[model samples]
Target: MSELTVRSMTEIEFGQWYSSLVRAYADEQVAAGNWSAENALQMARQSNETLLPDGFATAGMLFLKGELHDGTAIGVLWIGLTHPRGIADCAFLYDIEVESAHRGAGYGRKLLAAGEDVVRRHGVSALELNVFGDNDRARRLYQSSGYRVITQQMRKTLTDER
Candidate 1:
């Protein structure tokens, strides 16, 4: 496990991070069968239209980059302040990604732990995140990190010929 550092994203870093986020979102959407590849790309572009340039500056949102001990960028984490179930204030992890090449090196786990420390400094006691059903790796990571399933959402595809 390398020493992890989480820092506020600079403007120059935002462009690369945003691109990765959009790509991830589209891929997840496609995996979930919510949209075709083409449609997912279009929808992802549209969905992020307002989020760039300055959206993360909104009330209680944070965009951070994770770096290794040598200052190599390893990942990004986006968190938003939210109150779930009237719990007052909690941190919601909107997105987290470890660069493809850095996967399986324990970077993701370190990045998440660093993220929790960042959120905790903001006085948030709880952290919540949503992971797609098909994302087994992420599910396992979150579970190992002490996150529990508070709810489960299931979907069914009905056939017209039936």
Candidate 2:
């Protein structure tokens, strides 16, 4: 495996990161039946606007890019510092994505480990992330990395009856 490095994203990389994030979110929304493909893009835009009004500049947010030692971009991560009502301050991973071409090369694991290091350096002792139930690959990665489920949500569709 090649060396993986995570660095704060530069302005030049923001556009790519934002675009990818939006597309990923939209895809998830469609898969979850929250939005139709025809409107997913628009809904994604509006949701992002509401959630990240300041974009990557939002307070407590950290945007990072992952690359190989040879300078090949492999992934992007978005983390946010959070203080839940009963727990110490911790880091929440909002998004983590390894490019499709780079998948299965261990880049995802490396990138996540690097993210842990980055958050730990900031004095945070815990990290949290949410993975959709259908993303088995990602769920496996997170599980192997020592993340256990703290909570889960399930949904089902029922036939309409008049």
Candidate 3:
């Protein structure tokens, strides 16, 4: 694995990536009976637009270009913000998705650092994000970075209700 580069995503490129990534994830989730793709496309479009253009929001996308020795675009992280919610001034997250081969290379830490700076600059008093309970690796990263689990959101998928 070669060095990974993290950069601010241009509006066009990030829009492309955001849509593609969500659609891919949506397809998989629907097939797995985890979610309904009923509104996937609409949601993806809305998310892409809102996520990138929100003046109060920013996302740091990571990629390994030349380092993609295997001829693949490896992702390092995805840190961004969502609309604010109760008790939280705003929501921020260290959505670190390091390329499989680059895990443990400190990309998580770097991405968190960058995202925190973004959140602080926006005048958010508290940073908040949700993490999968089963994701021990991600939990460790957040915990080490001074983020704790404030709450857990749970839902049960209902299928065949028709």
Candidate 4:
């Protein structure tokens, strides 16, 4: 019931956060039907390594932790300052999450606002993120937060039909 604050993650925190992020990302991939459970962990690790080649010191990446004034961790926000498509000053939101235990407390929006403030301080003009189609809750949150869809993808599973 206090103000949420975002700050740079420490090395020790990064170690634990990275481990949990890898597992959670793998699980999310499997749940979204994007990767087989058997290979999801490996793939997730590879993907993360590719994006964060220097680990916590990656030059253009920012790994932030969100917590309340009382120091209860709400979640994390990971962002990339330099986008690949040659978009100047456009930041990419790699990940953001509100811990399950704190989900309905409006911490998500607070965390997002905090993250945006960080990006704004960096003089970044735009921020973008991708959400899995099946994550209706996340989609709704993003939409309600004034984030409009820039692109969309759709698929039809044929395994059941054939």
Candidate 5:
């Protein structure tokens, strides 16, 4: 497998990348029963905008693209420099996605390693991320990458009959 290279996402790549991210995130939310189809897209956009007010130049936010040495785009990773719990020098991974065509290959793991290296180079001591309960694949990848679950949120549907 070719080593993955990580680089800052160019402004030219942000538009299409963000669009796909928003749509996919919305779909994931809908699938997880957190949002209805009608409002998922809007909510995704709002959440992303709130997190990335300055777009690619947003302070403390890193938008990165992963590729092979040959320049084949393998995936993208979005990480935050500030840790959620106020831990200094820690980073949060907002998202990491391997292109659909590259799915099931080792690229996801490579992309994640690349992201970690980038954060480490920035002086970050640790990295964290959230994976939906239903995304078994992602959870497995993360676990195998040495990330342990520090917290979890569970929910149960309650119907009028129940």
Candidate 6:
């Protein structure tokens, strides 16, 4: 297993790395036809906005950076707090990606552990995420990391031209 250091993203440090995450996901999702390129960057813009933390922007939100044995960030996990569910807060996870070569090195697990530690300090009792049903690997990771399916939301595609 490679060594990892998880830390909060700085305002100046997030631009390039975070953009790569968004672009990579956008390219793949568009190529797979899961999303439309027809939105003219609006979808991406909105996602970027919501992904960044606002209320507890410093310690409450963070990125997981994994280093090679020699030190390089081959993985990143963007994490934040979701809207409170009951009296406890929920951790919202996104932008979690491990480089193709580094996926099995347990970096993702370390990131989740780090996220749990951070949120727990703030008195959170549970973590929640909305992952697409098609992402089996992610579903497994989240489940393995101790997340349970509280609910499933279904969406119907609108055929009428917008």
Give the top-scoring candidate (lDDT): 5
The root-mean-square deviation over C-alpha atoms between each candidate and the true structure, in angstroms, is: 2.2, 2.1, 5.9, 1.5, 1.2, 4.4
In candidate 2, list every pair of residues with a backbone clash: none
Q: Report backbone clashes per prediction.
A: 0, 0, 0, 0, 0, 0
For model 6, residues 79-152, the per-residue Cα lDDT tens digits are 66555343246677766777787777677777667667766776777767667777888888889888889898
Model 1 scores a C-alpha lDDT of 0.85
Error of 1 at 159 (Å): 1.8
Q: Which tens-of-lDDT digit does each residue in 3-54 have in candidate 5?
A: 8899999998987899999999999999999999999999999999988989
- The true-versus-predicted C-alpha distance at residue 87 of model 5, in Å, is 3.4
TM-scores across all candidates?
0.88, 0.90, 0.58, 0.94, 0.95, 0.72
Badly placed stretches (over 4 Å) of model 3 are 1-7, 24-33, 36-82, 86-88, 154-162
Point out the worst 10-residue segment of candidate 1 by lDDT. Answer: 50-59
Cα lDDT tens digits, model 4, 1-162, are 689999999999999999999999999989888999999999999999999899999898899999988889999999998775667888999899888999988889899989999999999988889899988888988899989999899887887665
**Residue 74 error for model 5, in Å?**
0.6
lDDT, candidates in the order shown: 0.85, 0.88, 0.56, 0.91, 0.92, 0.67
What's the true lDDT of residue 16 in model 3? 58
Q: Candidates ranked by TM-score, best first?
A: 5, 4, 2, 1, 6, 3
Given candidate 6, what's the lDDT at residue 145?
87
lDDT of 6 at 124: 71
Ranking by lDDT: 5, 4, 2, 1, 6, 3
Model 1 clashing residue pairs (backbone): none
Best by TM-score: 5
Q: Candidate 2: where are CA atoms >4 Å away?
A: 83-87, 160-162
Q: Judging by lDDT, tell me the better candidate of 5 and 6.
A: 5
TM-score of 6: 0.72
Off by over 4 Å in 1: 49-53, 83-87
Poorest stretch of ten by lDDT in candidate 4:
153-162
